[model samples]
Target: MAVHGRTEAQPIDLTQVRAYGDTLNDGAIALSFSLPVPYGDEAKEAARQLVRQMGLHDPQVYHAHDLGEGYTWLLVYAKSPYSVDFTKISVPKVSNHKLSHAAIEDYWHEHGGGEKLRVIGACTGDDAHTVGIDAILNYKGWRGDKGLESYKCFAVKNLGAQVENDRLLAEAAAFGADVILVSQVVTQKDCHRTNLAALVDLAEAEGARGERIFLCGGPRLSHPIALELGFDAGFGPGTVPSDVASYLVQAVVQRRRENAQPI
Candidate 1:
């Protein structure tokens, strides 16, 4: 395409774009799920019919397997003719997401200039998942960035998984933690929301909410929800340890500066 002697490819219509398989806008989609019915011809038909009922066209049961105990797993292929304005969609995210690790350390050294700040983290409640918390607090770190345990500016303690809220609060208080990090992965019946709220309540009861920065991170967490739960910040999936380290350091430095007396 050309406009005024300048060449440029035509832009895709944001409102009309569809999922592509063999070609653009083919609306090809593949879904995998398990059905409680036994694996058989009737089960496959049920899957196809269910897909059709959900507004997808030409549902094909490509594969089926017996998952034991009257359960059947299936891979379904279908075409969805739905489209949305991609440009009109928005997702909430951290606004100060670009700070580097070194920058954070420098700010702490210049502003607080105190000994290593204590940080305590764990998966609180009945949730036993530790992958999210470990990735951010373990020395091995997630991917390449060193976790908080490896940071020179932080004295980190990860209480492992399935920590009770009272225990977490007691330990954080004993350590005089500057940051209280929490991770919740098991969200059945919105339990994560409840567990996170309980932690906030505990902090408030102990009058620690003002002294410590409360951070909650997990696969289902977001900044808005975390704020709603009375947390200083919230992190979601795919967030690296350095990203967290930077944010907390920035927040602590800012807090300290605001508390400093005038010359």
Candidate 2:
């Protein structure tokens, strides 16, 4: 229980915690969604009543817009009367160790010596979104971080969007790439899954198993999902060039050591 804008000192319980909006434990919340109903007075009332039915109190319909053809988008603010066990929640994540752009280049040159690490990246399948891959591989980083292209140590080959998995594998073989990066942005009907899986399966069919590193990245990609899909790693939202560069360079160094090659 709370008043005004402060939390009332109560027993700390993570097992069941309510949302905090105007005050601590207030259970206040906000949500926006599109409903199948047309926008009108009835739609607003429907939204308010809907929130109330969900155990929320003081439901307020903030905004509602008709999205044409009997569809309405709405924003609602209300107080929820439920909570969950925060202590039992866990999410898998990628590498905790991130390398600087300079560090990545320095490590590659100092470790790899004469051979520059070759990396091939592409947006395989019918997904033609190049923005994601371009941001990581292009020199002018997407949101401020310089891409792998800016790094002097890596030989990056970005084949752009809508590349075929078989072509990617052929290029990987011809280029003798040390890392294979696949990006899929169009996830309509979970097509990213099928496209990414095809790349992995094709690489295996080509007998390139255990040779180069396989990495998948996109908005829908996750480390756990990538691992399960037979990839060495996966990169998702907010992933910068340095993060991918760090992992690939480190993995390459490890591989070099395992092969008794100087790195």
Candidate 3:
């Protein structure tokens, strides 16, 4: 949480707190969950008693529903009767360089950038899921007004689900792509590791290894892991188009400068 105002209240120490729920004035909490039981007044009372037994005070069952068959859902409000400090806590985060959309466009245009940036995206191997890849490449942006297609500087070719390694490389070479986005959803049996390594190996064999940026995305992919596997960067869940676009434009500009520099 970002601090915006000063208060006389002593800072709450969240690090030592073992509570998890909404902080109400009287330590009250409202929760919902399902149970495999028949719905009725008896069941509702049982749920209230269960909450009370779980250390809450004066548990009250506000609603209960029969979710067909024997499954029942219940909503309960109860007093947790506990409080804690709220300020002493911290979490690790990625520190990638943040660049605005205009900045990216400016950098690219300054460094031989009118040529449409070619990007190839695929869900490699037998991982037939396309949701992750589509989230980044699809013209219809996800979670608001943001996606790769929104950027006019990039020409993306998203090869949806179940793409083979050989096919991806062939297309990248054919398209003269400047970047390759690989999405690996199935990590079972370390298939993700093997597939990622194969792409890098193929790129090296084709002499396009370091000439283009290689990006990986998945539920489990991370920056450190992608770097270890020879990728330029990694994006996990919650990645937007702007994030990838920023990195690609900056990287392309830097590469152009390095190649043009006379030794």
Candidate 4:
């Protein structure tokens, strides 16, 4: 296809272009989502037919397994015959430096140690999941790295699940905490957002909002949403203790520098 008075050329923006052929092109994508079905060849054929009916071509079931009693799981690949303008989409992002655990420890040592920086963590509001919070503050490590308990300068107080916002704030004040880490595991009915918001509100009411590094972690929490909800950072699943520890120590140092406070 040649344009008049011009040589043949490809589109500068190939964002919305979809290629059609047997080979996987740049537009090709593999998708995996669960559907309640029995594990069998019938289920696999049904999945392929469903994707084909949805306009995808060459749908192939790579693997299928029985999730449990009467439940099935699948991984499939197919050529999607759809495309969208990538330039038309936008997303929020969190901007923060990525530092290793060694760098963080070095920074703490250089800044001055033995100050006993306090941190309070809990799983707030009727949510009984302590695994996330424990992974951050407990003596044991997660994913082959030492937790905050290994840091000599940190005084970590982990208040377990179902904690109230008022209680958290009161304890923070009492302990003169430098940071507060909140973990929410239950997002059922949007309860996680509500509880997170309430904690922020309570911290503001107690005049300790800006005095500490407020962080939240869960399977669904993100940095953008956390920033929007007034958190310094939000960590999701697969987050280890060192990640949170690194962030907290750096945040404290940054805050002190910004405030020009002598420590």
Candidate 5:
């Protein structure tokens, strides 16, 4: 197609995208579910009816197995007749440019010329998981990225797991921490959310909210959810040490510039 004496660029049709199986836009999907019924022919028919009620077509009970205790596991193949406008979807994400371990060190050297960034990390509340905090704060980092402790620009203290939020804040005050890193792994009954929000609220009440950056990480945490919960940033699963390091450096540098201080 030509527009205004120029050929128009071809754009993908994203408004009606569907799951692909053997071909594009086939809408073919495989679903697995368990039912409290015996593994038999009746279970297969029941699975098909359930798929039909879900608005899918041509439900095929390809596999049905006995899970014992009157339970049946079923795999169904079906075609969905629905689609979503991919172009209109929007999601909040961390906007900082990812930096390598070496680059982060170099950037801190160039921009952060004063005292090292003080970081205090802990697995607050009843959550006793330390793997996430250890990955970002320990010398032996997760997956091969050197942790913040390895960086000359940061002084990190990993307080292990299940530390009370009040203790975390008090320790941060004593350490004069510039950033607070929180890790919560056990989120049963939304306890992680409650614990995280309580920390932020306490910080605000103690007048430490403005002087420090608050970060959180876990399997359930996301950048958007963290912002909503009053955190400076959030890191989810698969986050490496360098990811948090880069963001800290950039954020501190920007904050210094905004305060009319040397970076």
Candidate 6:
């Protein structure tokens, strides 16, 4: 229990957590989807029955619209009968805390031993989008944060888009890269996953896997998904240049410590 002034608040049970709206433990949920049917009274009933089949109770179709091509969109409200144990959830995440652009620059300058961290970034494997990679590697970064190229601690070489895996690895070798950043914005047919996994495989084949850190990012990628695809870490939407900068410097420091090398 928590007390605020003279009032007390009940502790939430983590073992049976459910969605709440309008009232605590109400389990109210809103769902929206489209079906291949014309909008009518029958369409509303179909949506309600479909929600019931999904194990939701008291499903009420609040809105329906016709798409003019025999398609109907629906919005429904219902009560979810199931709950999840919040304590059982576990996720792999980047270990670095949020550091400001200035703070990261300061730390790297103080401990970097006069050596710049070399980073090679590209949008590999037929991906034409450069926005994600440029936001992290170019001097003109996304939003208001300055990118890695603007920092004195990092030596950045952005290879632009649609780079092949072997060429990217060759460039990393030639640049003596400390980190390799790959971005895949085109995810149609799971091509991003295929390309990222192939890059790791090629690096391993060339005995270059353990020499540098491999990081990938995209709209569809997450840290867990990146791990599954054999990347060191992954970034997704809304990630600023400072976030990647902070993670790489800290990761380099950690790796150097593990190998008993100077920072």
The C-alpha TM-scores of every prediction are: 0.81, 0.79, 0.63, 0.70, 0.81, 0.83
Writing each residue's lDDT as its tens digit, candidate 5 over 154-218 gives 99888999999899999999998989999999999999999999999999999888778899999
Candidate 4: residue 219 Cα off by (Å): 0.8
lDDT of 4 by residue, 52-111 (tens): 887888888988888877677778788876776777776664345656778767777777
Q: Judge candidate 4 at residue 17 and give its lDDT.
A: 49
Stretches of candidate 4 off by over 4 Å are 1-14, 17-96, 112-114
Tell me which residue pairs clash in candidate 2: 111-263
lDDT per residue (tens digit) for residues 4-79 in model 1: 3324654557878788666566688999999999989999999999999999999999999999999999999999
Output the TM-score of candidate 3: 0.63
Which structure is stronger by lDDT: 2 or 6?
6
**RMSD, one per candidate, in order:** 4.6, 3.6, 7.1, 6.9, 5.6, 3.7
What residue runs in model 1 are displaced by over 4 Å at the alpha carbon? 1-10, 113-115, 187-190, 204-210, 220-230, 255-263
lDDT of each prediction vs. the true structure? 0.86, 0.86, 0.79, 0.81, 0.89, 0.90
lDDT of 6 by residue, 131-201 (tens): 89999888989899889999988999999989999999999999989899999999999999999999999
Which stretch of 10 consecutive residues in model 3 shows the poorest summed lDDT? 1-10
What's the true lDDT of residue 205 in model 4? 85
lDDT of 3: 0.79
Task: Please give, for residues 1-263, the per-residue lDDT of candidate 3 as tens digits.
Answer: 32323234635455444343443144667889887888888788889888988899888888889998987899998887676555654333334566677766666676644687788899999999888888888777667736677677778899998898889988988988889999999999999999999989988988888778899999999887888898888888778777887888777666667777421
Clashes of 2: 1
Better of 2 and 6 by TM-score: 6
Best by lDDT: 6
- Candidate 2 Cα errors over 4 Å, as ranges: 1-5, 8-12, 41-60, 78-82, 205-209, 255-263
- Model 2, 1-263: lDDT tens digits are 45555646656578987897776677889988888998899898888888888888998888999999998999999988889999999876665468887888788778887788999999989988899999999999778999888888888899988899889988988998999999988889989998888777877887885788899999989999998888888999998888898998888888778878755
Best by TM-score: 6
